[model samples]
Target: MTTYPPNIAKLFEPRPRLKYLEHIDIAPKERSTPAVSGLSGYLAQLKSYDSEIQYTPTEGPIQKQQRERRERQRVQQAKVASDLARWNPSEDPQIQGDPFKTLFVGRLDYEVTELELQKKFAGFGPIERVRIVRDQRGKSRGYAFLIFNSEYDCRNAYKESNGMKINERELVTDIERGRTIKHWQPRRLGGGLGGRHYTKTRVWGGRTNTFGGPSGPRSVHQTRTAPRFGTRPAYSLRLGPTERRPYERQASNERPERDPRYGGKYGVYEKYKDVKTEAPYKYESRDSRDFRDRDARVPERREREPARDKKEDRTTRFDRSMY
Candidate 1:
């Protein structure tokens, strides 16, 4: 009899017995039994185990990590390529003419330099030129124009830039098609001074001259001389107080009085007054005393009176034959 260790014997502890009668005298297969198979299989497996299966080297771990990273990058690149293929430049037609020459409005970053702007927009397409309208001091006015080689590029730029907020302000991109051209015209300075009334001049350094200097000639020292008109004698027309002009005063006085004949103080009264006073007008009331008295004085036609029978007597009869 082969004696087994207690740990191995626990695998084959008998509980219920089988009563099959194929071969009563034959012993059970030793290799097929749990006690014999369990320990023998473990021993064979341990003898065949390699040390590489137990631990991986540092380089192997690094290579596995790098493989995972490369896979992620490839996936990202594939997605970007897919997006680029779907982008349509010609579906929305570009604005006609040179895009770089076109003006734009509503930029956000005033401090953003031209190079920075170009670089930012270059992601959309090739930028030809960028101009920021500035003050005399060359400070940005929060608006700028970007030009591109193609209209498609401009359209893309407009799509990307419009309503783009920078420095807390939203950009408003537009095409400046109808901007008015401004010309620098020299202003006439002395034109205001020559009028009959001494017109007020924009005083420059205490001078009454409209241009504030000599009218035409330039001094040898290049300094502007005082205007000659200031020294010229001005004629005065003096009038005594209460010197009432017969026609002027009457005309002025009669003009206001004539307004009352039409109606009241305001011009509105004339319409109401005409409707009340005018005869043969539809608005004149039939119930008025003037209408009643006029109707009473005019005799009624005898033919219009109620007819009486021949046998009936007519009282207070007047002669109809009198013309």
Candidate 2:
């Protein structure tokens, strides 16, 4: 018979029934006292049940994976934000002095919107956002602003998008200026009292008062018309076939005499004759009939004195003869 340690036998006997059979058999076999029973399996089952029944909570694999994913996303977002803040255009030699990170897209179709701008510029790099300018009526103003995630992307998009065509129109893309621009307004060509108030003025005899003096409101009676002869300069008359002397413009100290050749000696009568003529007052010429009226004013009154003698004496001659 052989004997084994209690601890060694405990290792070989796992079941209670197996331990009992080992104790009953004694035929030239290695035998020993069974130090332990099959309580380890029961203990494992109890441990599992205890864990299930306990109040303390535990996360599953799926929940643990989801938490890890959310943490990673948060960290990535924070890193992106910090990078944007720390990015210095002055430090980058490639950026030069122009630190603009926005692209000014012009000549865009009137129908193009914010989403179209994003779709077109996104291929260049990561875009921060897109903004399309609109008017007071909520219509697209045919331009947009594209902001990128980095300076390189901004420059790249600017270079590549220049002269690019969309909706059959070539686009003009450039680096955005740092200043704010006023919204575009159509130039007002016609408005107020100055535009529609223009009258079609006709200048007569090739003469206009355009450069003469300060313009005053013209009355219907103030217009002075030129003579039918011509309006050539007085110097030009010297060059004509008539070869006249240079007209000497002298100042007169005495009042000019009214000749019978024109109208009459009376100023009022002369003006009345001028007003009855077709010519303007400033250019009225002498009339042949005016000379005939000059003699008729005086001798015609002496001839009218005989008319009174004829009427009174005709009746008196008969009465005197009877006396």
Candidate 3:
């Protein structure tokens, strides 16, 4: 190791070129050795293990006992009443302030302190209190709560401070919804508004993305920089019933638009539906005078024949049998 200069300024000074240092012999470069594999490498590894694993053999029995003890402790801890009820939103007594006026600040840095949180958010409103949740061992759980004096202050803080960086971590802030929202469950129990909000679980196969993919096109609202894109109406999430909309009921009282491919008509040559004309289709007409295909394939209508008396028909059938 080279010795450092006693003075800080001497460190920045350029090094002097000595004759002996310049004449020092340097080794020629050589290619790095290729890695070995297959049976030969396996044998080499086996040879090394005999000496390397000597320390582990003596510790095995001790380690086994420790593992069993740890497992038993974990099972015992899980049975404890406090441990079982640890994450219950309603039952936690340490939670302070009104749910409406308190902000549940999550995604916090583990090192951030309560005093720092209080001071950081002090500009929003008068902070009633600040609490950074900790585990049984007093390690920060990367979440905290800030209690504001009023709901307005809480709302302001929630709006402005969410996604704000503190201690190199983006904070996720929201109003305490445990009491306000029904059937509330924390993230640990598979429910959380913040973490899930950032998730890419949004269904992509909407009108804009009929056949979605990994690099699908974004919706009009997302891509547009301005509030309104040209003269087009603002994009809406609600199932559309607006004018000139497709695949849904129209909001207007105008005439129902037909298929544009068939010239806004249901029939190819004649009118299928006419509320004003009351014209019926050719096949639907019962008028025999009407010109229509009556081929075998088209099922031609037959003339009705006179009905014979049952007695006469029976007599004819008996005569034929006698013959």
Residues 1-323, model 1: lDDT tens digits: 13998888877887888786775554656335445444765776676686436756566778989999999989877876665555332342443336344537454487877786677677777767787767899898766677777777677766677776666767677654323222211112111111223333543333334443435554232332224333222221221122222332335446654455665665657757745534433323333212222333323311334443455533322233122
Kindly list the per-residue Cα lDDT of model 3 for residues 169-211, writing each as its tens digit. 8888887877889867666555666553333334432543233
Candidate 2: clashing residue pairs, number:
0
Task: Report lDDT (Cα) of residue 184, candidate 3.
Answer: 71
Best candidate, lDDT: 3
Query: Candidate 1: lDDT of 204?
Result: 30
Q: Which residue window of length 10 is worst by lDDT in model 2?
A: 185-194
Ranking by lDDT: 3, 2, 1
Q: lDDT tens digits, residues 1-323, model 2? A: 13778877777776565443444667656657767866767888888997789686799999999999999989877876666566443454433222367787887999887887788788999887687878889999777778788989998998888888888888888765433232321112111111112243434334432332345664322332233334423222112232344434444655466555664566547667745534322214432112322344443332222122334574565564355
Considering lDDT, which of the candidate structures 2 and 3 is the better prediction for this target? 3
Model 2 alpha-carbon drift over 4 Å, by segment: 1-99, 180-323
